[model samples]
Target chain A: MTGPRLTPLAASLPDTVPFVGPETQERAMGRPFRARLGANESRFGPSPRAIAAMAAAAGEAWMYGDPEVHDLRAAIAAHHGVTAAHVVVGEGIDGLLGVLVRLVAGSGDRVVTSLGAYPTFNFHVAGFGAELHRVPYRDDREDTDALVQKAREVGAKLVYFANPDNPMGTWHEAGVVEEMVAALPEGALLVLDEAYADLAPAGAVPRIAADDPRVIRMRTFSKGYGLAGLRVGYAIGAPALIRAFDKVRNHFGMGRVAQAGALAALADQGWLRDVQGKVAAARDRIAGIAAANGLRALPSATNFVTVDCGRDGDFARAVLRECIARGLFIRMPGVAPLDRCIRISAGTPADLDVLEEVLPQALRAAAG
Target chain B: MTGPRLTPLAASLPDTVPFVGPETQERAMGRPFRARLGANESRFGPSPRAIAAMAAAAGEAWMYGDPEVHDLRAAIAAHHGVTAAHVVVGEGIDGLLGVLVRLVAGSGDRVVTSLGAYPTFNFHVAGFGAELHRVPYRDDREDTDALVQKAREVGAKLVYFANPDNPMGTWHEAGVVEEMVAALPEGALLVLDEAYADLAPAGAVPRIAADDPRVIRMRTFSKGYGLAGLRVGYAIGAPALIRAFDKVRNHFGMGRVAQAGALAALADQGWLRDVQGKVAAARDRIAGIAAANGLRALPSATNFVTVDCGRDGDFARAVLRECIARGLFIRMPGVAPLDRCIRISAGTPADLDVLEEVLPQALRAAAG
Candidate 1:
């Protein structure tokens, strides 16, 4: 018998994962990595209060999580100084990006982003049959001018920009971001992804009116709150745009335990400050290890440090391969120029010790 | 400045939630639900092993769950006597259905289901711009022949049939299901949702070959496993179809604690057996309560029972309202014939005492 006929769009899409998780690599290698630093996950654990809340909520696993996500939304709104109607929570920023793409970008609709921005967002845009137009990064940071200009030229529906950018850990000042928001063409929404906002320097985060219809910004608990495994992220936008998410979202998708954990995590700002301190220290340690190995570490405001291999993409690839072979997990950008760098997330002091020991060996092996 | 313009389809769709969560009602009423029976959650709770596993995993929440989901997928495969290639895990069956609809049913593609089938599935179809066609239930069961006929007539890409169906608690035997599968149109896939399979009779689940490309069957931890709050569900199908989910799914969507909890829950089938016994006992208790009140309980193969109010949809709705007003949270079907009944989920001995106390008063109020 013939199988079901897939839609042309589905059939045309490549079966590719945006990120090959470290677990897949571990399985292929037949051993676990000594240091889990890939994927930019927090090496520091979530707040103890969050852990306790989740553990307590475990017994109530028989009931569905609140579909409206009432308590968490209220708490998030208070944290951001916005009304509840301005916030929408989803599985994660990745999931919310997919829904946001579906909401605005129809088949053949033009969407714009930088060449080396989050591949997951590009995956969503392609999956929805939208035409993606990407501009090259100007100087390892996303080119704001080129992105907005491209959006205007294409009459784009959505434009994606991440502050404290991934892979490079570089950021723009709040004023630059405000200019980008102001320059966004009519009918083109700016998807200002502030996933690393919690760790960003104070002046790096732009302050836009909550009701500004020009932008929808996403933030995640995965980074600063150290709850990556909880899969909670949210968007703050104009009320109308936020309400539109309910039309398509999986209403009861959030887990009850996750809700409790996030609530407790949000309440523990002291723990967040502690993580910020640890992350900053870890970033410096990673940079020091990079310098010892004769590689250049990029300036970073986020939790991770991106080290330039001081050579081409091929050399960086070899260095990355050597590190993986040496039981250290790390990643490099897929695009050129940027691919000259290897991205390393902040790890514990012990994990960093492994990195310091392994880097010289890996560099020597790569050179050979 | 104007907001981003929504795609024509998204603009046409009205913002709606598939189900109003009990928590929302509680907030409006200024109290908690005395008996939360509306959502068909397992009051029996998850296995203690699962709770323990999740509680332990909570401390590891900083690390993202393995996106490959290797261990859990392998375990689920072993349990079903299928290779891991034949399985794909997701946030829930609701989330999986959304992806499946996107994979096979493009905008304007025809899909068939019972008029009063799972509203969430319908929401996904609508969200993706697929055209949905509904058939009426026959003898309180899904009309399999009608669904198949309509699929052939309209060249439908998908047909959804839930055995031990929601809202009505009716199911078809294995033979009937096999016949229906055989009758699926050349390009139409059958979405056999077995959400309540663990609680169904011996012959209710069909033993389809793993490589059979004509159908995909979904199972969940939400119902019989008593982990509704965990949000873990899986689909078994042809390897090619299962792999296609990766192209569009949120690859790292499944939470770490959720994966651990589900793995532990699957290992402890003894807990499942215990839950089955409890559900069966509660079903009997609910049926007795209905009989005592001079109402008819539909013979159920599910964790919930549907009791006919012996009048019209209006009467059933009135009864439901009274039940809600009395601090009992229960639901009625949204469509006619089915709407002539109110559905109640299995509860603890203590919870059923509330239902027992409240159902009679609700009926009396409706009568008045």
Candidate 2:
């Protein structure tokens, strides 16, 4: 018998993940990478308190987590000086983006983002049958002016902007982002992704009013708190917009251990400070390695550094291939211009030692 | 200024949670429940092996979970005597139901279920703007024949049927369910939710062909596996249907610790057997308590029992309220007929002691 038919929209969509994880790559390679710097995960690890909290909550997992996510939201709200009504906790920024897209953009709706920005946002837009408009980055950073202009021209429903952007490790000043938020077209939502905000310079992240209706600032524990595997992220927006998430989100989605871990992680800001320091040192070490290899490292406000190969995208891709072959897990952007730079995350000193040992060899191989 | 405009369908939807969790109730009462049995969770707890695995994974929470969920899917597939291609794991059945509904049923598409069946399924259908057709339960159990007939009548894309149904904890024989599966409409997919399958009697679960394209069987660690807080569930279906989930699912949604815990939980079948025995004994104790209070406990193939209060829906609701007032967390179904019964979950002996003491007082108060 024939199987059930997929909806026309689902049938038209491709079966693809936004990012192929490092574990999948390792499985294909038949061995683990010596240096796991890809995926931008924090290798310094979560706070000891967070780990302890998770371990403590492990046995109590027979019960469902609080569907309301009340305590965690309240803690996050207190941290941001906003009421809990202005925040919504979700699986991650990735999952939240999916729900936000569903709540605002429908079939044939227009969405705007940088050409080489986060692919997951585009994935959700396409999954919902929305038309995506791409604006080219200027000076290796997301061009907010062009994005705003494009959104207005296309009558877009959503505009995705990542401060301390991925793939290139570039960021905009807080004032510039505030201006962009204020300039968003009527009826358009600005998805200001701050996934890397905690690692960025203080002045680089804009302080928007919690009740700002035009923008939703997204943050995650994955980057700063070192809880990527826990899958906790939240968005700050107007109370009404935040409440709208309840209309479509999986109520019991958050794992109880995750909630406990994030709560502990939030309470342990000292651990976060330690991670930030380690990330800064790692970034400096990565840049030094690139400089010694006769490559230029772009200035970054994130936990990663992007090293320009001083060549075309193909040449940089060859360098990336050599690194992967040498068991140094690294990634590069998909779109051109950005692709000339290879991205590497801030890992522990041992991981960086592996990278230091492999970089020259990879460059020589690519040159040959 | 107005916030970003919600899609017409999202705006029309109400802000609702399918189930009000015990934590929410506890918050309202400003104290913890003496006997936590409202959510049907296993107070017996997860396998010790699972707890240890989660504790081990906690330190590595810095890494992103495998987006593919490879190892867990392999383990699940091997347990079921099927290839890994036949399995798709997700963030529990609630999350999977949302994706399944999105894949097959779009706006205006018809979906069928029992009138008081799983509300989460209906929530997803409504979230996607699909029209829902619900048939009333037959003899307190889900009427598979009526659901299938309605699916054919309305050309429904999906039909939801829960084995050892929730709320009532009643079930049909495997032989009868097999006939209903074979008779499903040509274009309809049957969502066979076996969330309580492990607690069911031997021979009650029909063995369907692994390649059966008309049905997708959903099982969860939430109930019998004692992992509701972990949010792990899986669906077994034809390879084509299984792969289709990638189109819209959050690939990295499953937490790494959860994956590790479920793997260990699967390997420790001894723990599962022990839990099953505990569940049976707890069920007996719950029934005894009901009988002592002059209430008739319905025969349950699941971990919870529905006790008829020998009165109307309002009377049962009063009984439920009294139980809650006395700090014994219990729940009753929302609709008529089923509302005449109060649903109590199997709990630990000490928890049951609290229930045994308070239930009579609750009954007396309701009578007054």
Candidate 3:
């Protein structure tokens, strides 16, 4: 009469989501939020051409999507000025992280990442029974040198660092990141998550050779391209490393509309440029609102601005709760120091108007 | 410099796709497929309501899909007379199979399935480093009793059985399947893939209780709902087993448009019934065509018919090649006994007209 047996690794794992989506919160709250700016998604929607492509492809959904993702890969390769051999498209950076961890790290193998960076990466590493080594951020930025040193010390199989980083909205110059890449141990692969690369200032993303076997850079259409719901991302690496993904990935996991939409999005660089300008304006507006509320906003190069509440973790948590209570969906880091800051994604003017009105009230409520 | 090191298990695995999609073949041939009947996709297309829903949601593709899949799960639960707790939606059955295998069977764990039943399932088992013990089909149908015996003998953690099976399109009565479920070995969970259940005849699918812990039934929108490219599938089981998926699944894997499309498709069951009728008629037409070509068409409960080529595996392969060369897409099983048959999907009138014109020529070419 015994029920099914979960593997010991799975049984030991916690039942948790890396991030609680805003939709789940809305359901729990029994109402939708007035401002949705928590997940770092682009407030400006995708290009009209991309939307048209997706709508046009809707009826053709009767056929399975191309398993190889041929066209999208080709376009991504061309965009990066590389050949198709260096690209591997997947369900998103989240999906690709899972596959990447599974490919490199086995049970008990050591991996390194910045603490409070991205929970999804930790989740994947833990799900695979790999040992995780965390390095703390230095001055609100990912400590790349520390990460590289830790990997060497632990004989780590993989090391993860995100440029134009999440949570803190800080980044290192391409030259600094290039030096860190050079410092990577021979056996350790550097997973350079460039999810916000498109939004970063020039020279923030390193111009590495596409065939650099020591690093795999991941880019997504979710943020700057405004197609978060489509779940399309691609990894750029050596041909051999990229091809290894073929061994374990669910080949047909990419939706047909997703492929078409991403291809259309990639084709419209003008839309991307316009959105970047909009995001910059939105970020300045968010910072101005924070300043008006007597909060210090951290300098940001990405789509989001991290505001320092100038308080402890509990105080920052209270501020976040007050914002959520007022229907402003904002989030904060999960750990100390970084937890003292509240993260806010750049939203449209209307969305920011709601935020601007609520932040003062939320701040007063948190102070009380 | 050395590249990333793959895990021993990943290194040991072969870099091969379980099914070579027709799209890949078309790319190789440097042309679009004239008749896409190789995969058993619903050529009649999704419910117009579903297509409209997807198109409408296309503009809102900036928001991430609900990770909980709350509304769709509730709708699926209502349809199956189960609670939301009994359902877990995923990125197609292929993706779910990978997660299920990872959860239940670890490296060196035993899993049982019919040989050549589903290569995708085998792919997942291998990807997880699990040892698979396959029981061959008997009389061109999956031998459930033999599978049960093998599971018991090997102490298998999971056993996979597909009702209204793929490739052969043969099925057993509900009572027989129920008996097999009851006979499942302790600690073994039966994975009943009902991908084609909506098209199955009465008594072909068992009326199992949703709380049955010994079995997890998987259903897909790809077949009957005609949304193959959307990649939505759901697994039904006891609340405990269903919730286990949350431990390891990609939370944001399901696309927003896919959820909307599936919800709309489920609401329009009338469209489902109409598609079923069309599939039935197309199946009959395919059988008639086979008979006229001096081939024996097997009894089928699913969307495709398997025609015995009156020869061996090589002859069947030659016929399949001829069909492809004549600009018609058809497929055949890859293993022995079943490899002697060529499989054709039910298509629209226009698609069938192309098939009717090309199939006879294919046979003649094969004979020569």
List of clashing residue pairs for candidate 1: none
DockQ of model 3 vs. true complex: 0.79
Per-residue lDDT tens digits of candidate 2, residues B1-368? 56558899999999888889889999999999998999988899999999999999999998889999999999999999999999999999999999999999999899999988788998999999999999998889999889999999999989999998988999999998899988988888999999999999976798899899989999999988899999999999999999999999998899789899999999998988998999999999999999998999999999999999999999999999999999999888888878899999999999999999999998899999
TM-score (C-alpha, index-matched) for candidate 3 = 0.99
lDDT of 1 by residue, B1-368 (tens): 55448889898888989888999999999999899998989999999999999999999998888888889999999999999999999999999999999999878799999999999999999988899999999999999999999999998989999998997999999999999999988878999999999999989999899999999999999998889999999999999999999889999899899999999999999999999999999999999999999999999999999999999999999999999999999998999989999999999999899999999999999999
Residues A1-368, candidate 1: write the lDDT tens digits. Answer: 55447889999988877888888999899999999887788888899999999999999998899999999999999999999999999998999999999998978899999998899999999999899999999889999999999999999989999998987899999999999988988888999999999998999999999999999999998999999999999999999999999888888999899899999999999999999999999989999899988888998988899999999999889999999998999998999889999999999999999899988998888889
Any runs in candidate 1 off by more than 4 Å, and if so which?
Answer: A1-3
The runs of at least 3 residues in candidate 2 whose Cα sits more than 4 Å from the true structure, single-residue gaps closed, are: A1-3
Q: Whole-model lDDT for model 3 versus the true structure?
A: 0.92
* Alpha carbon lDDT at B74, candidate 1: 99
lDDT of 1 at B114: 95
What's the TM-score, to 2 decimals, of chain B in model 2? 0.99
Q: How much native contact recovery, as a fraction, does model 2 achieve?
A: 0.86
Measured on C-alpha atoms, candidate 1 has an lDDT of 0.93
* Location of the lowest summed lDDT over 10 successive residues in candidate 2 chain A: A1-10
Instruction: Give every collision pair in model 2.
Output: none
C-alpha lDDT (0 to 100) for residue B180 of candidate 1: 96
Task: Report RMSD (Å) for each prediction in the order shown.
Answer: 0.9, 0.9, 0.9
